[model samples]
Target: MARPRAFDEGEVLDAALRCFWTRGYEATSVRDLASSMGLTGASLYNAFGDKRALYEKVLERYASHSMAERIRRLEAPDIAPRDAISSFFRETLERALDDPEMKGCFVVNAAVEMGPHDPELRAAALASLGEVEAFLTRRIEAGRADGTIQNRETAQELARMLLGVHLGLRVLARLRPGRELLEGVVKPALAALDPHVPG
Candidate 1:
């Protein structure tokens, strides 16, 4: 029979996410993952196959883990989707401020590092954006029907613009004067999303 796995999968993957989140996929070596997880290089290979395999798992964990929870919070029934989406950006800003490490975002980081010329990685990054945008579009459409938001734009277009704000905000968060600069970006974003626009 095959030997049982030695390490806790969840703990190790979370560590990998943090490492990847901090250093990015290409910068993290197999030795780095092994040392960080208290595993030998061979053990890591046996458990996760290779660096790309491990990085893929890290991306999966990032989605199903706390990231999904954030989406859940935003889509929760108790909060209006419009309000919840606004709070999501503000909350992310707070999270960035609270963490002195300046990790930015996992998906945004991946988008920068691997988005171009890599079909698989680009597709994966785009799928995540699609998920968020679809969710936003649904809510925005609902809002439009209920007289909450103006129906000037299609749901799909509005969703894409909202996602653009997130992408831009993550990039801005990595800079030196991040928060104040982000506030400028965020405020204009809020105004653009406002339902009542005087003609």
Candidate 2:
């Protein structure tokens, strides 16, 4: 009978995720992944297929635990839509500021680095981004009904705009990891949706 592998798979994947997150797909060699993941080169290939395959898994892991979860919270019925958006941005800013290296979103990094050539990575990135946009659209519609959001645009348009703003904020956080700078970027973006505040 074939023997089962010894190492904890989840632990190894977590280690690989961190390595890919830090170095990115292009710069991170399989050797780096193997070392960080506590596996031999042969073992890494045997388990995860290859570096690209491992990175795809890591990106999905990040999406599930981070990006998708945040979007899921935005859809919660208890919170006011406007407040949910505000809280989301505040949380995002805090997390970005807290990161010493300011690594930004791994999925965003992968999408850019991989470009259009990698259909799988591109599709994964777009699907995650679209989920957040769709969630925002739903929340905006709720806000309209309850009179929380006073924006003139349709929920779909507003959601797209917010998605763009959020992505821009993520990029800025990597470039300038200061609270003031990040806050300055988000304040007006949120105000654009505030009925009490003029655009």
Candidate 3:
């Protein structure tokens, strides 16, 4: 029979996440993960397999707690579709502003840093990004059906554009976390949703 592990899995995983978030995957080492996770090297390997496996776990954890939860809250049936879209961006902007470390986003960082060479990582990163795009597409479709979003573009097109804006905002925030600059970036995209606003 296998022995039960002694450490708190959630706590250690969170620590590993912080380590990876602070230092990109390529830069972070097994020793770093062990230190941050408060586990010996042997225990780290025995429990989590390896760096790549642990990183995959961390990505799953991040998506569940961050992206999945946010989508669930903002996509509630009672909220107006347009409002949900607006609130999504508003909350994203707020989070970017509030991040003192300017870590940007874990999923996005993974997509850029390691997604190109690593197929598994690439798929994982794309899946998270696709979730956001899917959410935006759904909301835009709803808004259009309800006559609230008056954009000329199809829901998919608008959703893709908004997803680009979302990615750009997070990346730019890392370089310049200024409120005026970020809000300026968002204003025009949001305006595109209203027909009354002259294109």
Candidate 4:
């Protein structure tokens, strides 16, 4: 029988995720991953296949849980839609803005760095962003019904605008902008959805 692996797969993947987060796919070496996980390159290949395969696993791990699940949780029965959105952004951008490391986003980072060159990676990135946009669209539609959001802007347009703000905010926080200035960006963007607020 084959010898059992020395390290935990989940732990190794977690380390690999951090490695990919810190160093873009092309830049991160197998040695880097093994070092991060306290394993050898041979072991990493045995456990997770080649670098490309490992990166794909990392993407799946992140998307399946972190990205997709957040949108799903917001759509849950108990949470108010607008309140859900507030909580979602409270967790995503607000935390990104305040985080000392300011890890913008794994998917966003992959999008900016590897997306243009890799169609598969680009598609994955677009899908995750689309999920966020769709979530906002649903909430905006709900807001229209509840009167939390005005009906002036089409839900599709407003959702796209908000998604753009999120992407921009992620990139913005990478520069470590002051919390006040960063928070200022949201009020104006949210104001645009208000019927009384000027365009």
The ten-residue window of minimal lDDT in model 4 covers: 190-199
After superposing candidate 1, which stretches have Cα over 4 Å from the reference?
none
Against the reference, the lDDT scores of all candidates come to 0.78, 0.87, 0.92, 0.82
Instruction: Tell me the tens digit of each residue's lDDT in model 1 across 1-199.
Output: 9999977999988888888888988789988898888889999899999988888778767766666677776887888767876787788778777778888878778878988866787777777767777777877887677667674778788788888987888777887536788788878776666777631
- Better-scoring candidate (TM-score), 2 or 3: 3
| 10 residues in a row with least lDDT, candidate 3 | 190-199
Whichever of 2 and 4 has more TM-score, that candidate is 2
Ten-residue segment with the worst summed lDDT in candidate 2?
A: 190-199
Q: Write the per-residue lDDT of candidate 2 for residues 1-199, one digit (tens) a residue.
A: 9779989988999999888878778889989999999999999999889898998888888899888898787668788888888888898889899899888888788878885789988999988888888888888888888988887688999889988988988889889888989999889888888889653
Off by over 4 Å in 4: 1-4
Model 2 scores a TM of 0.94
Better of 1 and 3 by lDDT: 3
Q: Clashing residue pairs in candidate 3, if any? A: none
Residue 162 in model 4: lDDT: 85
Clash totals for all candidate models: 0, 0, 0, 0
lDDT of 3 at 60: 86
Among all candidates shown, the one with the greatest lDDT: 3
TM-score against truth, every candidate: 0.93, 0.94, 0.96, 0.90
lDDT of 3: 0.92
Predicted structure 3, TM vs. truth: 0.96
Candidate 4 residue-wise lDDT, 60-154, digit = tens: 78887788999888898888766776777667756786668777788889899879898988888888888899899998898778777785668
